[model samples]
Target chain A: MYRGLLWLCFLPSLLFGQRTDSLRIDFRPLLNGVALELEEEGGASAGAREVEVLRFYLSELQLLEGEEVVFAEEDHHHLIDAAQVASLQLPLTLPPGLRYDGLRFTLGVDSLTAASGVFGGDLDPTNGMYWTWRSGYINFKLEGTSPDCPARKQRFQFHVGGFQAPFNSERRVTLAIKPARSISIIIDLDSFFAATDLSQQYQVMSPGELSMKVADRLTRMFRVE
Target chain B: MRQGVILLVVVMMSGLAFTLSSPPGIAYPDHFPTTAYDFRAHPLDSAKVQLGRRLFYDEILSADGTISCASCHSPYNAFAHTDHDLSHGINDQIGTRNAPALFNLAWSTSFHHDGAHHSIELQPLAPISHPAEMGSSIGDIVRRLSEHAQYRQAFSESFGDSLVTGERVLKALAQFQLTLVSAGAKYDRVQAGKDTFSVQEQKGYQLFQTYCNDCHFEPLFTTGGFARNGLRVDTTLNDFGRMMITALPEDSLLFKIPSLRNLSYTHPYMHDGRFRKLRQVLKHYASRDVRPMPISANEQSDIVAFLLTLDDRDFVFNRNHGFPH
Candidate 1:
């Protein structure tokens, strides 16, 4: 009787098959095609800055095939922190046999979620991603030190976020890739820094024209290999 | 028999889960405005509300364990500090701007003097992390709560398990705050036909409707939005108000329009707490340095009489809203 009851519990999963295969969305931040290790001394030069903290929000993962979306993440607002190694990898669950040609995602928190107040898990206010003085989240955070900076302690902080128009910092990034278990996206920090005028325009702590411009350039930093 | 027992246990557990989600306990008169807070997101239960009350009163929320939300927003003063003009934090630290009152917060879409924060659930983070306020981070507070045995048990009762999180803490605090509806004033009684307004109050009400009703609306007693009330900017503070948040010149000198309700309990009006009495606030309005509102001394006294009727003694001293005994 116990065996029969236990079989009934597994019957739905076996017949209708509620099994899911998880696709790993992996991020590997590189400095000139080299892995960026935080707190690594000698990485900074006269103009070049050493990255101390690199954190950002990655949301709404969508698997597409030539303009047609096959799978989409309902609420995948993940806080990817460089300090936490495990946070670099985000897992998106899908049907076991599902397939797609391309992947797309928003580089920051969506406007709808920003207006919906606070939530738990990755979106919690305690994560320090949300702003204290304002109503928006810090969609992307990059902090470092350089010898060329004019600010306090030669440090630079670029916190980009704004939901309102004329200053919204959310960016959409897309890349075509073959079907694979683990999707590895290399973030070319060199391309980002090379494009940035870091010497003069380093400090962008609030959401504005500078933040919007920096967020637009971030889309080109991703390379799927 | 073993299979039957397992089935019975599952059915009983489901019943227990159903009892956990309680009915909405936020009580307000039917005449009040709809709630801006989403009760569906953070449902109000007795256990969670009770837990929030303890946290609000406890000094554990601060870095030096000397301040809480109540330290600045005392219940006796309609959850606003009357002893100090500026917000006092840990270690003799003084913050800019007067701490605003915290009653009927469910109706407010924006928080703080400048309306900087949009969500009440996430609003506490501003004061909790402010350098001159509580002087603590939400992450550190979660760590401290995780180690406490009493809090762990309280978390288990409020939430599902003893695992403490910033989300749970904020939601509980919001639920308690949402329950602080202040619709029991004599004005409400007059509206309900239980009492009648005096002749002077009636004249003041007419004058209020003609002059103040546009910004400080009727029923709720405020528009619940920001306005430029024409107080000369104090050079020492140099507070740009809403302009600081938006970085727009058009939004300069705009501060939140506080409710005229409970004005007697919430003394020292305005964003800077500049006016110690109601007559001084009226004098500034008539002074017309920023905006013109010409009124005689008798008219001002009549307005003060009407404002006094806004004080709700039942709400001010409600034991449920007070510090947990």
Candidate 2:
């Protein structure tokens, strides 16, 4: 009689506890498996070229459980290089029991931080993120000599950053992670280059419309794989 | 020898008495504009002023703890920096612009050459964080100050709480500078009819009224507006005066029109400290077919003489306000 009662309580507890489990997320920028191809309007193929990654800083990161911002950070000063950007995992703590329905984050620094006075540490000019003469960040820098670029021998540089009324360039995205599993978010480089033509808007040096245009398109290319 | 000694003794006695009884505040005359700085925010307390005086002289604000505000704005030369064009900061790093005079700051609407700082309270942040200036963060300065028992007690006394922040540091500096008002001078006496300008000074006053008064207006001697002032841009710096803030193309060469009251003490005029002498400033104005009206050489001399009347000796040599013992 006692054994029957214990089994009755244990059966429902095992069934409900494992059903709504936590999801671990690992964000990755696909470096090797991805092939980037930039084609102009005329269907002219732009060949592959070696490029050095400028920097990747968290402009904004937010974990949304429904409408509320469960966790958010503005002007986070974490600096990541090309090698690190290839595979990045940021551990975030969430509220217990409530699974995150969607996740959203940005790709570059905001316009206000760029315009506000001198900053030290990761934001400093010594870090090579700041533009010395011109005022703004060189966000999403891709440098390599290309056949399509005007300057052939010298590295073809695309430094995009802009945030203002007309030139806002911070990118935002939402993705779904599976239940009770680690979600790996992959940034496909092929889709980023395909979205916008680098030949037309080649070098972006400040917080303006062009930076926002590229960042908005590039941020959407990120997906949960 | 005995008669000469008696005369010298009497002179020394009179000097000692005169120094003891001297008034501390500026004596304003009629016809000047009212003071703009709201002294009510931080009421003038002799004790608080003394505390602020000590902080100004203290080098604890810098990261390396090497420089202070007094290291730049010296008290002897009417609170204007001497012997340097650009103000130097920690690690001997040179700044881009010249440090302006500190007296009569009560009348100033804004601070810095660009007017980047709106309130006088916010002015120290410019120097505190500037890479070429103090080269230290405010948070770092607070942490350093909090470690010292003297600063910890003083912060509690001044702010009521023991916490030290950048806002408190800036406020203390502003409190000290706000007390530097200059109203007593030959010009004030002449305005009061207690004294009159010399014949040359009168001619200079006339010339000043005609040309300089449009911008460098009477009383405070500054319209307190940013102007082109006809300065050619320095090639290396390429600083766009007010345009750095507004991002407007028209405000490219414009800078704040500084007060001309202490022309005798505060040498090296203009934003870049380009001119060493008052005659050079007069010459620059006289040679002005550039932006404002064309001022003549004869008129320039008159303006210089008139500027001399604005100097207040009492405000400059006030022993109470000088470096604390």
Best by TM-score: 1
Task: Give the CAPRI rating of model 1.
Answer: medium
Q: Which pairs clash (backbone N, Cα, C closer than 3 Å) in model 1? A: none
Compose the digit string of candidate 2's lDDT tens values, residues A1-225.
Answer: 999999988988777656544555565655436533322232233465444553565657776778777667566755545545333556554445655567776666766666554455556444556443334555666555544555545345667664444555555677764344567777676576666465675665555455667667666657878
The Cα local distance difference test for each model comes to 0.86, 0.68
- Colliding pairs, model 2: A161-A206, A162-A207, A162-A208, A163-A207, A167-A208, A167-A209, A169-A212, B204-B302
A86-189: candidate 1 lDDT, tens digit per residue? 99998777887787899999999998899876688899888989998788889999888777767776787889998876678888889998777898999887
lDDT, residue A10, model 1: 92
Q: Report the CAPRI category for model 2.
A: incorrect
User: lDDT score, residue B242, model 2?
Assistant: 78
TM of each candidate vs. truth: 0.91, 0.59
Model 1 agreement with the true structure over B162-224: per-residue lDDT tens digits: 988888999888888888989999999999889999999988888888779899987888788
Quote the lDDT for A214 in model 1.
88
Q: Once model 1 is optimally superposed onto the true structure by TM-score, how far is the C-alpha of residue B291 displaced, in angstroms? A: 3.7
